[model samples]
Target: MYLFTACCVLCGEKVKANISLCEPCLQDLPRISCCCYRCGLPLKNQLNDTLCGQCQQSLPPIDYLISSLHYAYPVGHLVSQLKFQHHLVHAKIFAQLLLTTLQTHSLYHSIPLPDIIIPVPLHKKRLRQRGFNQALEIARPISETLDIPISTGLIRRAKYTQAQSLLNAVERRKNLRHSFALIKPISAGHIVLIDDVVTTGTTVYELANLLKKQGVKTVGVWAVARATHHYK
Candidate 1:
């Protein structure tokens, strides 16, 4: 039998079977350790609380947030390549990273495995322009690996809003107002929302609100990366 070697998607360094990043690159990755359990934002002093000050004051619509990496450096670059440059390999790499994170979290935390995965939808116009939904692309491999089905038609982006990254928190919220609509009734008790990166989180908040309105009991977010305060 012949053997095969894999190369790191980011550094192009040869890696062992079923992995992407080299040891140095993997060590350099900005994995989130101490973070708010609700929003997954990195915390300065974790202390006794799993939530940050903002979350303690007011909880987000989401029940839990699971993010693998911080939206910085190489992670950001990889997301950009998948989102803008149409490099599908990056999406596969991201899905693999997310799978690893979920497996690790399941060891210690009682993270509920979702009944179904719903990738944040894109507007039809945007989908036509881009030729692919990055969220769905990122979710495909994850769904396959985790044995969770993905539903692309459960939620629809009704409004063609401006990019969330270009707007402030208030503007982002306003932009997404009435932007998403549930396409059908959801029977799943637990649902996982998949996204490439979560910034101010206004987008997911809006989506979560809609899902809850439709009687989705639990809404969890699974993102490849989470934005830091500096980026937000």
Candidate 2:
């Protein structure tokens, strides 16, 4: 049961203590009922193909990917507020939703708990402008709940590129190329990348490729939501 009373972040309605939104609002959040296990893309027929066509052709560097919701409706609104409006509490809301998926999703049982959780790094300029990396904030609760260390310095965002959302699939890949540099050594064989939202999966793909070259045996992703419109 909820502890006390608080204002819902989404609706400004009264909610139980420690809850982000009212029950109705929470229930209205968009969800991904079926998706590609490799890239978190929503799929129409999981019974026919577990992996999407892109995944079947060339596997992403990610060993597994999990996104709990579609980047739609109030969920997208929440993410926008968190990213641009400096609403840090939205990070906690994202963490709580992702944590629930990690515990209950079918894929959860197939992969070992990550040795370290790496929130996708932001370029210095972006980090300075935003004042925070939303992914890192979202990852904090998960790290504490799962008892996994959050590795902040293992990778660095070396290039300041255009925002992924502003580009098409090809452009997104090109925008992120060599953007991340491994600045620190990591002994953890199994690691997971955390992000606020995953669209084309280019960012995580680049990261996972880098990790693989560095002898990281397994790379996975945990994202709050997935944008399925563009994948190339």
Candidate 3:
């Protein structure tokens, strides 16, 4: 018999099977301590109130947002490697981290669990080019851990739009208009939308609008990372 060993992707330290992170790397992962509860944008001050200035001025479409990490430092590097390089090991690490955060974070623990998880869909052309939907890959482990079924066929990207990271907030919103459509009827009361990262939140907002129209009362977002500011 052969024994297999796994090492932490970040530190190269030995780890148990089925996990990519050692204790140190897991503890060192960039976490979002304070953020807007509505959109998950990192905040400067730690206050009792969860909404940021922008969220207070204009409420987000989604009922709530829960993100595990900030899009900075090593977390951003890991995401880039996973998304562009197809390093699926990073996806597993992300999913595991997200699950741990959801289970332990007081804010997330208080919120009601979603009935089903729906990963943000990729356009067919982009999906083919990438060979996999990063969101879907990230969602699988979360689904298994939470015992919630993931629904991928309910919604689809009807139009291929430019990547959100490449556009400003205004352009991102404009680009995503009418980009997604509901393919089949959804019966879930509360649905959680999963994505790798939330930059401008335009993509999730557009998709949430479609899900809300289908009578999903509570639409929440679960992402690996949340961008504090808009990307250039």
Listed in order, each prediction's TM-score against the native is 0.91, 0.94, 0.92
Per-residue CA lDDT of model 1 for 1-232, tens digit only, reads 1112388777788987465677788888998766788887877667313888789899999988888998889988888777788877777777878888877774225756799999999999999999999899889888887789999879899999998888988888889999998888989888999999998888888999999988899999999999877233
Name the better of 1 and 2 by lDDT.
Answer: 2
**lDDT, residue 165, candidate 2:** 79
TM-score of 2: 0.94
> Could you tell which candidate, 1 or 3, scores higher by lDDT?
3
Q: Worst 10-residue stretch by lDDT in candidate 3? A: 1-10
Give Cα-based local distance difference scores for all models: 0.83, 0.87, 0.85
Tens digits of per-residue lDDT for model 3 on 82-147?
889988888887887789778876666676788999999999999999999989999998898789
* Model 3 bad stretches (over 4 Å): 1-5, 16-18, 47-49, 230-232
**How does model 3 score by TM-score?**
0.92
- Model 2 lDDT on a 0 to 1 scale: 0.87
